[model samples]
Target: MEKIAQPQSSFMKLCRKLSPKRKDSAAESQHIKNGDHDKNRHIEAVFAYMDANKDGRISPDELQKSFMTLGEQLSDEEAEAAVRLSDTDGDGMLDFEEFAQLIKGDDKCSEEEKKMELKEAFKMYIAEGEECITPRSLKMMLKKLGESRTTDDCRVMIRAFDLNDDGVLSFDEFALMMR
Candidate 1:
């Protein structure tokens, strides 16, 4: 693969910096020691985006719409359930604190379950009988997600997350990128 000299977008830089290697205890401990302020800031940004009406709360409709914008089909019932799970004050909406807590609680899922979800997502970009994500597969997935990038751009993205330097993303690399 020919290495392309593409300027990294801020989002891409953040993704690159945040990509965790398998069992990188040092990085994990650093994130914990720093009090996860960056993570909290990201959560706050997401909350702001989901609060479509700017009422300082996320309603079920807003949640559903926000997820839809991200290409995830969040049904109304599922959104209501999510709000109920986090709406501690019985307000039927998610305030910033409640939203933060809800996201934090997502970490409670078992490692096995998380791995299964990651595996399923990884499968979306791989061909039948393939075990890794090549630039071609990634380009196709990115196009499906409404982002049009050249194959070289996809190669650059894969290189950013390809810890093994093999010009492709294995399941472990994909899991690390998701982290």
Candidate 2:
């Protein structure tokens, strides 16, 4: 049997409209490079894991349970509110696309807020008073996160987004890499 194609959600449409166009083939290729591909796959894996009972949709209970598994407590009201925020179909459950939107966060977040959050995350890998992230810092952060990687591997990762040909990642370069 042929599978039916789902309609695009308004959130996705807005994202496409707001996102920048690729400059060239190289830019397009880099956009889908290994790290991004792995991130997307990881998101799918998490969503699948959260959707208990083998259902395509995630109910509020399932979402709450998933949060508990991660050692985070989520109230029923909060879970329901989260589902309502992204439930375009009013089904009271989240399909994969809706879940993705929830994961990305609501549209209410401002650009400045996003930048602040990114800066905080970036700071986690850098030393005090340091403005750039070096390979040593990146490798140390990755190790702390349970993903062991060599300093050379971290250096190559930074080189991919090192726009100024610098050996480290400044905030601007890190922001671009996050995108």
Candidate 3:
């Protein structure tokens, strides 16, 4: 049998109440024109992939750890807040249904748009319009983001995602890390 979306939890209701209604712009209209079926499937797959333990729900701890893996340090409170916003079943965790519902209304960007955004972010890590990021530049950038890492640590971090083994991070490598 097909599962139905759960009734919205109080947290979800409150989020709805606080969220301002956006007037759809040209971009929003274009997004609507592009079908969301594939996007929905992708979101579902991602949710399942993130649920790591196959527990049918994602805990705040899992979310926090995932953020850390991506170099984003989230405080316990911040992680809990994120879970609360999406926990539409009042279970303190997110099932696939709740996850789907939570992201169903999101403005899903096109692959091209995503690439462009990644490229723009990659540009920020480059110096003097250089095409790639050296370990020194990467360390400086990470330091700017409040992450204190030694040059060796930065090199290690780059090598972790540096597919070409060129001793630096290219735009493609950076995009892979971002994705």
What's the distance in Å from true for residue 39, model 2? 7.4
lDDT of 3 by residue, 42-137 (tens): 555556555779898988787666545434455687667766776877889988777766655333545664465456556656676578988888
lDDT of each: 0.66, 0.63, 0.59
Candidate 3 positional error at 175, Å: 11
Residue range 63-129, candidate 1, lDDT tens digits: 7786565445656777777778768999999899987776665555566656665665677678667
Q: Compare the candidates by TM-score and give the number of the best one.
A: 1
Off by over 4 Å in 3: 1-34, 108-179
* Pairwise TM-score winner, candidates 1 and 2: 1
Best by lDDT: 1
Please report how far candidate 2 places residue 143 from its true position, in Å: 1.8
- What is the overall TM-score of model 3 with all chains considered together? 0.45
Residue 122's C-alpha lDDT in candidate 1?
A: 76
Model 2 spans > 4 angstroms off: 1-40, 46-101, 105-108
Clashes of 3: 0
**How does each model score on TM-score?**
0.68, 0.49, 0.45
Which residue pairs collide in model 1, if any? none
